[model samples]
Target chain A: MTPTSLNHGASAARPPAAGTFRFAAHTARIPALAGVGFKHTHLDAILADPDPVGFVEVHAENYMGDGGFPHRALERVRQDFPLSLHGVCMSIGGPQPLSEDHLARFKALVDRYEPALVSEHLAWSTHDEVFMNDLLPLPYTEETLNHVCSHIDRMQDVIGRQMLLENPSTYVVFENSTLNETDFIREIVRRTGCGLLLDVNNVFVSATNHGFSPMSYLMDYPMEHVGEIHLAGHAVQEDDEGEPLLIDSHDAPVADSVWDLYSIVIRQSGPIPTLVEWDSDLPDWPILRAEAAAADRILDEAAHSFLMGKSHAVGA
Target chain B: MTKATKTAFSGAVLAGAVAAAISGAQLVTATDAAAANVKCYGVAMAGQNDCAAGPGTTCQGTSTVDYQGNAWKYVEEGSCASMELPGERMGSLEPLERDMPS
Candidate 1:
């Protein structure tokens, strides 16, 4: 499934031992139910009385430094929760060759904290030498497919485990794209043996902004490749043509439509680890716990239904 | 493992252990106090200083320096309030209301 006949040169070398490296089974001690992204504001609460969520996720880029409070806090939570390193700045889908420095930093973090799952965005963040510090969109072209796959392969090889790629919340589309975002992502995963971090809110936002049906996108998405799910809130703006464009803003609660879509996704994919990402304008810890509880109820219902189906089969 | 290798790996494990202990300490602790002396600034493109409060926004007055090592100008509500005041260092910064770009 190599894209464009290009193969990442394989070496027999093992990755440098950075931190406490552990496999998924050891890393994710808890089952992949509902989790929340960790924030600095909630660290004390999380430390005092850990949330009842199944696990927690954090941005790997935030912990790339030597020694700090972020690392200390994460280490505390790691004892009781399965951690997934959801990185925001890897820029795997960028046009330029991957930066070895950034890759080294990622490796160091992975080695230090053996996350249950490691993930990055399916978009670029830098062009030439300018770091835009945003997950810019990528065209679904063959060249990009190859570029992203190579980056993922390099990451997997360096980290000694499979990585997850999250779909981008795009504001603009490239005219030269030959494939839709979903198909391109599927191809990347199929080629690199990576997983997908499906941000359902991003799908709804991008579909609304681009005049597409989010329902259809969900229908066609590869369910098995999804290792985790993200639910967040968005803000919508109308263009001069009076068309609404939704921005993936994590300052609010999950939209009703998104929650409905999430329930449907849970029915389809079973209960995977879901996260409520509130990066900006974070509210009190109680508000976030309530959000996690909502996701927990969905997962609980799904699990109950699953068991009921199994019992029915046994009786039959 | 080589001596150096063992040493580095030991250090990392020790760090991981310390991080773990701190995680335990943080559970019963209060939020750290904010830094007192640190200042925040935003350097935007020159001459487009309509940086005032918009709908659902607030603006503050501050001073900014342009490229080419020029003097600082007092910016009020995203507009230049005072003339370019020259000094060896950038003048005292007045807090400007920055509209959160949604």
Candidate 2:
């Protein structure tokens, strides 16, 4: 389950302290530490905070402007924090072809920024040229497998970088989906050579919605390809049958169950670049930092366990 | 943790504030009054255009909704609905399925 075969040379020495992340979870060309989703609200606070968090992420659609304050702010912030460009409306899993204009704008942004990590969801958000602001689920079939893989390939070709594809939280399943979600993603990674962004909240949400095990989904997932990890909070409501339906709302702090699952993945994957994503209803700056600092504490513990050759019982 | 990091961070912070000032002056000319109270977090991403009158589907703030290119100019907190520009019949943001899908 170790993302790579790097020997850590175990020592009896314990790690420094919680919230002090010293090493990269997994080594990449752009090494990273604990990161958070970039909200314009936190610009001044982030600029002023001396202890740098690993990186900050931005929604691609937010910065598609040719010339604007967003770009100015982003370019300035990029000086201090490594950036991860996240695409909210790429619609990569849709039946329609990838939007050339969207791709061009994204490419321009990527080219200008040269971000360390760029990611899009496995869910589709656009169809027939109308942009829906939601991440819709995809049916996992051989046809979908081929279609998504080709899209990933084209994206890598145009963007000139390996983009991380994130797992989505689903409410409904298609009868035609022949492959399980994990297997579907594994095939995409195997074929496209793109990386994975394992969103633990999504796993927990979809598993609870579909009546499955989050751990089992992780077991089946191709963990080695995971370049980044996402941790967020979700809202839970009941379905028509009075069943629990989890919504991927990035409006709150990291949930307890999600933090536990993230702990399990960290032990298995040995410290990936994890991000705290809060898109809407954003809290004050210190609250979000507290969440990122909390993720840092967990990552610190996982790295300590790995370094000390202990069982994955750091937080368990 | 290192001196190098602290120095870089402070430097970035200064640069971000300075850059924000420059852009605010050059692009968002109308909102200087609003800028007095708003910080970075107060500004959401260019509020997505609800109708075709919303320009800049390709660009972020070019929406014909508010200011020509500055429809995304930071609106006073809780004042997005009141800030009206020309030819604007604003559509509401679509609500997510809290309990059930329609």
Candidate 3:
């Protein structure tokens, strides 16, 4: 949906615990299992059946508006399922300073919903006060790192919650870039004390586009810093020169290779809150649920192994 | 090549590219048409099948084909495009590669 669709629905709610900003202390935690992106198309099915999944995540910008079906339905879903606020428009990595207006809107939503987790991307989508509504890549330089940290700190202050930063899926890289994507992400988390939302599809897409192994990038990433995981679909387009360009289009099923990488990530990170992001070609609720179930299986396996490790340690 | 030859060659190249893309798209469309009969749902698009402006709707029908060169095709009910949503195509990658918005 256009960023404009975010307009005209639901005023932000003050979190139940007023005056205190430490939302994580009381907020229902995102269960370390499979959750699906909440789509308007599936609202009816969700309201009717409320099928069993770990939790549900919604694009924070989508519900920024005031009093519409989105708010009504999302409120109902919130009653039964834990929710995470995922933002697509914060422009945290843009050259210009972060938008206070958007930040205020986000803060209001967080206060109202008290989502289990909150996240924005490490990419920018705005420049010169114009909102492009696309997640543009950032140059991984020392200067950019400082700029992004200031913005993230400001965001955490305004929202009064620990934020999670997701890596952007890139098609091209800057020539003068000094740091790799993993290093950049680690530095951001280190500096801001924010958590990470490691999108496996993004790692695979960026690694493939930039001529690297997805495994190496995952190994290099600070796995302990990750608070959540994202698995989505991508598309490959051939340009005018007949070369394949990978695009992070969340419109299909998670690719097999990405799924494998996700399993590996789970083996390392234990079980983080995982989301199946199908933003465009959203399938029926059952299809999306099936995708979530696949993720659930991975999470269940990982949790079992984790428990086994703990028990063995106790015995020793 | 001279400017005239360059222009002519570019024209031929554009024609070839368009033809190839259309043929490839048509093949995909044909596959969807074949799959349509077995699909259990129907997806409807507004203009282009971009999630931003055209997140589409769930409706019952055989896949609708926009023969007027609009980029949306019904892959399945409750499903629109398999690849990138149309609006996403105009994002950063286009400007970075060609200095023009797609």
Candidate 4:
């Protein structure tokens, strides 16, 4: 279905007033083009040759430390490309209240960098005070919905910007879940006024593990509120029953099927700013650039088709 | 001893502790600047290492064990030898036998 057909309930939530925060005057909004996760090892190569890269993303937790090379490299990257601050450990879906210290650090980074887009996952990572460092899944129910919405509200209120909540790649489904993933995410957008970061590879991975249709999930997603898209590679494993299990391991190239799924999403969503994440087993700059380039081709095709369709409708 | 004499002795010990803390912080900064590229073992907190811990791990935040000796983080070159840990252990250039999961 077209994004226009989706309910725009997210608009009902209050938006931040103008001049609530000041971003760098020179920095532009992230364009509807392909971007890549920023790696420190790639700083030199990126500075030397910045092509086919529309923006760059970095994990928010990684830069939470006080000033150092991480900030230095990010500052350089920001000067050249639009930045997307992706937080991996906010534990937004956890039952406990959000961490005040983590929120303060997140806000500090946002104020310092003024990223074009900011996002976090739908999963939880912290239990009590202990952090698991992995995106753990939560059951979909009214209780969880309330908790997730409260966390997202706090996060946006602190940062003073609309943050995108990304869909997670799950290995298991909760038998007690009352709502499906799409409906759960849609409710989050409706309540929090946050946009969505539709990770197509995650859709593929979860679909493969749980035996569902990724296309159906995409169709049911709140596409109109999608602010960004993430495409990453996952590792293949086996469940106890010997069925295929997928880990959202950002250690390899995007699989062929995932590329196809991404192409489909791009075709439907037009051209949201897409990022290719390769956090581990990093390739040389050129190799990662090629992955971004691959995404660019899909985005380009989608843009071209969209323009053509617009013209055709106008002619009619 | 008289109360005045006991209080004066306590003040001296407290002052010494503060002085040591200040110098220790300065030493870390100085050594960090002087030798910034050394891979100091058993220094990283759990899930906070700069990179992989070992097999089955990928990169940052993948360490399952806290202060895993096998997981090394880059620190000042010579400072690792002086950095102290609990149980009288010190940071090592090579992975230490302590802190590994049994």
On DockQ, the candidate that comes out on top is 4
Model 4 Cα lDDT, one tens digit per residue, A1-316: 1222222323332233311222222244668888898877787788888364889998888787787567877899889888998998899989999999999999999999888888898989899889777888999999999999999989988888788889988888899999999889877876777777888888998999999998888777766767788888888888889999887888789999999988877775577788998987779999999999999999899779777784442222
Ranking by TM-score: 4, 2, 1, 3
Candidate 4 lDDT, tens digit per residue, B69-91?
Answer: 76668776776656566556543
RMSD of 4: 10.1
Q: Model 3 over residues B1-102: C-alpha lDDT tens digits?
A: 534745555887989988876765575555465344324444444233223532222111112234477677766665333344446744433323223322
TM-score of every prediction relative to native: 0.70, 0.70, 0.69, 0.72
Better of 2 and 4 by TM-score: 4
DockQ of each: 0.03, 0.03, 0.02, 0.06
Ranking by DockQ: 4, 1, 2, 3
Per-residue lDDT, model 4, residue A1, is 17
lDDT of 3 by residue, A12-125 (tens): 211222222233432465668788888767866766764578888888877877775668767988897888888888888976788898899999988888788888999887
Which of the numbered candidates is closest to the native, going by highest TM-score?
4
The CA lDDT of each predicted structure is 0.70, 0.74, 0.73, 0.77
- Residue A212, candidate 4: how far off, in angstroms? 0.4
Q: TM-score of B chain for each model? A: 0.20, 0.21, 0.22, 0.25
Error of 1 at A183 (Å): 1.2
Residue pairs clashing, model 4: B35-B76
The TM-score of predicted model 3 comes to: 0.69
lDDT for model 3, on a 0 to 1 scale? 0.73
Candidate 1 local lDDT, B1-102, one digit each (tens):
544745555887989988876765565533321111111323354333223312111000111223375577855675444433556245776444665333
Q: Which prediction has more favorable DockQ, 1 or 3? A: 1
